[model samples]
Target: MAMSKFWWKSDSSKDKSIHWMCWSRLTAAKCKGGMGFKNLRDFNTALLGNQAWRLISFPDKLLNWDPTLSYIWRSVMEAQALLVQGISCCIGNGQTVDITNSPWLPSIEDPFVHSDNKAISNQKVISLFKIDEKAWDIELVLDVFEERDAELILSIPLTENDKDTWYWRHEKMGHYSVKSGYNVIQASKNQPNTVDNSRFWRKLWNLKIPNKARRIQVNAQCPVCNLCDESAIHSLVTFSFAVECHQFSSVKQVAGDYHIFTEWLQMVFEQSNNRDICIQEDGLEQWCPTSSNSVKVNVDAALFTDPNRYNYAIVVRDHLGHLVQAMSKCSLGKVVSRAIRECRHQRSP
Candidate 1:
């Protein structure tokens, strides 16, 4: 948070106070309702955690260096402390784990702590199990721990040769990343999300009120229908021209069944591969084909005049002119790499 203050100070000489929302609020998504800025403190923490994640993820891949060579190794050891809460050990061979001392146990509550004084020093967790039977030594576990702890420990799977590995529990897959870790940390906070983005869709549906004319003092009414009091429902359904369009194409649309414009449009437009759209492709440039075996990405940023918001759309296509992926999202934060990364995730399976 101090870092945020320092940057704000450096950016201005006078009138330094941010006129809009505070830095924290601005970090929220516009749909959840804020101006959309990155929370620096959380972001920095995630980045540092990611660095530590890399070190642990590939133990053999780490570079060898002496403490006299650099202070980087010391920094990593310090950062590992923050990551402890979010990660857990995936018991593989279970050799490296100290059963009583390690956080490798699953139970979150402080139930029972087994006396490790009599236990053999550096004893592998596998020693408590019956290897021949491929099962936990239930009698021994019960002696060492309460029933709850015993059951949890018994559930852990072990292999003869596989080494114990780290598991980042935050993600569905056990993979760890700074962006995903950042989002996971952010989700832990119990922030109230009061904004309803669908209200804007409702606004779009009630176009009978002439939103453009009222807001801009200009008469921007429905051009195709030519109705003096044209609404989204009337323009898309009830208009004589629209009924003619439906007649021309064999499709049934029950008027007044859809209260929201988006739902109604989805019903109309969602065909397997065949779709017809009336909206014009404004400001679209000519398309150019890519080399064979290459994927083509097309991206565009748009502004909504009424709500006064910015959004971006990403579409991926194969060289054969087939659509591979399409994604549209409200611009949450500024980073081109983040935008492209999200696009790839949304790409067609």
Candidate 2:
């Protein structure tokens, strides 16, 4: 029967004929009522791939990879040697060598080679060598040198109050290096480039704090009460006014039908707590009067004694309008017929 249904002709199957319609509502961007389809799982994977590539490439500034010293070591060693010679001459010349004067040296404890009457002393030379080693360590070099996306780096010239300030901005643009120094580089698809300086200037000029402040102030007011002090929890749970809203009343009315069985059970338990209720050995549904100034609740055994009969459970309420007790007959089966009646009773009337 199930196999036959697979090939069964139906009006619903006509729409499912096209695979694109299964995922989306339209076909093309310009088409009226055309649904755009997107595979969320594939989109998520692609986004994650871009992030992973970014992490591996830009390990220097983003990951704090200090390659400044290493790059200098490979390309500008001669310049560094000249700087060292200048430092040595400055210290050797009779000018008082205050360790604080040298920018190359990181600390005051750095040792210097003092020339004793033109010839360099061996002890002072060794101290100078030690200081040089320590200075090299302070240059900030990374252990590993991995090439990163160059185009991702760019310098943005920002002006606040007619002051020129350049800021570095890095972002992934596939395989391209987005550095600010390159004039040939094109701006992002949505972003305006240097060629459109007029639009860019307008955007920068319109960037006022009051606009953002206005937006924040608009959303700052509570949706429920229009009060600034009203919060999410206050609107949903604690607010007495919120509970009186029409929406809450409508929701409660809809929920009442779904919780009928559970609500009835609760009422029964509450009633039994304050009143006397009796359960017959044979399952039956009945009511009896009590004498302890409590609501009376009783059950007859005939309801369950019949082997092929189905009976409904009864709920009893107290004078205070609270549910006081409930009783139900056992199932019409042999297991319950011989088993002791297990009637859970409570009183909270």
Candidate 3:
């Protein structure tokens, strides 16, 4: 009597076989390979760090404090701190301190001292500091600077006086408010000149969209899919395929009717994979026959005069050189009819 072998009966044996198979497949040809395995704990730690950095770098986007605001104050502050720290490190022998104390170092003397040790007298320092503070106030002056720079670059109709007036008006106006009397300062220490008022009205009226409103519009839809839900690159590239598949399935009645559509959909989905499965320039099709199945599947890209449109066709032929089933015209009817016609033709021959 011959001894019978139960190969997968033992857990340890099965586990070992599975492990060996996995590694063997990974080292296989690029076209026929398994997922390359990584240390799970290390990967998880790296992923967690990436998430933390994203959160820190895009606080407003992640936190949803004000959906209408594009700039994240906290993130910007963090970035500024990072910049100051880096600059301080480069200039000050790797010592990290407050921006004011380390690199900025305001002088206790009649004049404040810069990192360069330039002696700016108290009165001169105070005046320069005030002007510099106003000019460098990122939140207050960025919009003004951008607008003026754009006008200058584009060669828009504006004189030096007009530009100065516009700047002064913007300084007086401060930040915008959707409230009335916000711009009307009857009298103040920082009152704008009459020329500034004239430029202010012209520029303010010309403003097509408010930054806040623009931000709101931009954030209304998901960045990836342009859907209302949370837009993620993974969702658009990966999960959306499943969603589109489900949508296609809902419309398709027959099983194999969706084969070509699914294949095309997958090609579109995995486009980032950079593996060109389309028919090449030589007009040759990718025809590979499998021994396990007598039927041969031919995948080819259909060409049209229009370059913008992408149309693909997949055909499955029976072992007897007959088309048992077919789908075309973005519907199941054409393929089914083709299949029937081929079947009848085979019978007749």
Residues 1-349, model 2: lDDT tens digits: 2222333435688544434343323221212232323334333333433333344345353432355645423332322322222122112221233322232221222323121232222222122222423221111111111112111111111122222111112222223122221211111112444233455545554566554343333465554334435555445433444445523332231222222445543544554543344455687534444444566443345444457555656666664546787877655643343112211111112
lDDT of 1 by residue, 3-61 (tens): 45554655445546443447766676444454446787777777878877887887776
State, as a TM-score between 0 and 1, how close model 2 is to the true structure. 0.14
Candidate 3, TM-score vs. the true structure?
A: 0.17
Task: Kindly report which residue stretches of model 2 are placed more than 4 angstroms away from their true locations once superposed.
Answer: 1-178, 181-205, 208-228, 240-349
Which residue pairs clash within candidate 1? Answer: none
TM-score for each model = 0.44, 0.14, 0.17
lDDT of 3 by residue, 257-289 (tens): 222445545545454334433435687544445
> What are the clash counts of all predictions, listed in order?
0, 16, 3
Q: By descending TM-score, how would the candidates be arranged?
A: 1, 3, 2
RMSD of 2: 26.8
Clashes of 2: 16
lDDT of each candidate versus the true structure: 0.65, 0.33, 0.34
TM-score of predicted model 1? Answer: 0.44
Model 2 alpha-carbon miss at residue 69, Å = 12
